[model samples]
Target: MSRIWIERLAVVLAVVALAGCATSKEKLLTHDDRTMLDIWNQETGGPAGSGRASRELLDARQALRRPLTDTDVQTAPGVQTRYTRTAQNEIYRQFHRLPNPDLVMYVFPHLTGTDPVPVPGYSTVFPLYQRVQYALPGERVEDY
Candidate 1:
């Protein structure tokens, strides 16, 4: 009886596998796949039965073709008067710190005392300004 049950289970599994493989290979269009007319109708709030939508779109396009007037350009939401320069900002701009100049020095060969150990010649470099110092905007030329 157990052997008969095992054979029946195997046959059922094989049938299920074969059924899964029997699906059609054709591709299906999803709900999001829309035709151009569908998209146009959706965007324009439905078909322009009397061609009013097309006429309005054409009128808008033609209006865009004309050069923008000064008033139209200036009236944009992003167009605003420049903010008044704050005293702190002005001071910060005037006192902007400049990069310090570097100076390189080469030491000649020398000997140490006590044990008379010989020292080899070497070069050392250091910045001219060790601390931060601000200068007037036009006071110094930064052409280092």
Candidate 2:
């Protein structure tokens, strides 16, 4: 019984070892597999043949050269207004300047400490601009 068990264990170990040694035959391509030119050439009839450009592609390229008509200028009213409003709002924000005027304060000569030391008078300056405030969503701007 011990001999049979040892033989079975050895067989199992051998199978596991052999399984780890197995490798896939398929190889991964490190570079680009296929390019547009290669596909075009294949479809046209291999590398030896000249690939003719499709008519639809040539027509689309020619269409791009044509000048825009008045009909093309007229888009859907909703889309047009939305785009215009966005552009105008952006321009307004770019040119927007908040009034951050400077404020000056004068300090009078005063006494300090328990000994009462005299301090000279001096003036200090600061900007009146407070913290930046933004309007919340759905809130209307009463003043521009």
lDDT of each: 0.76, 0.68
Q: Any runs in candidate 1 off by more than 4 Å, and if so which?
A: 1-94, 136-144
Tens digit per residue, CA lDDT, model 2, 1-144: 999999999999999999876855453433558898898777766554233445555667898897768777675564456445576667654233445667899999999999999999999998887765454432543445
In candidate 1, how many Å is residue 17 off? 99
**Candidates in order: C-alpha RMSD to true structure:** 15.2, 14.5
Among all windows of 10 consecutive residues in model 2, the one with the lowest summed lDDT is 133-142
Rate residue 85 of model 1 by lDDT. 61
Clash count of each predicted structure: 0, 0
Candidates in order, TM-scores: namely 0.30, 0.28
lDDT of 1 at 79: 39
What lDDT does candidate 2 reach at residue 116? 100
Clashes of 2: 0
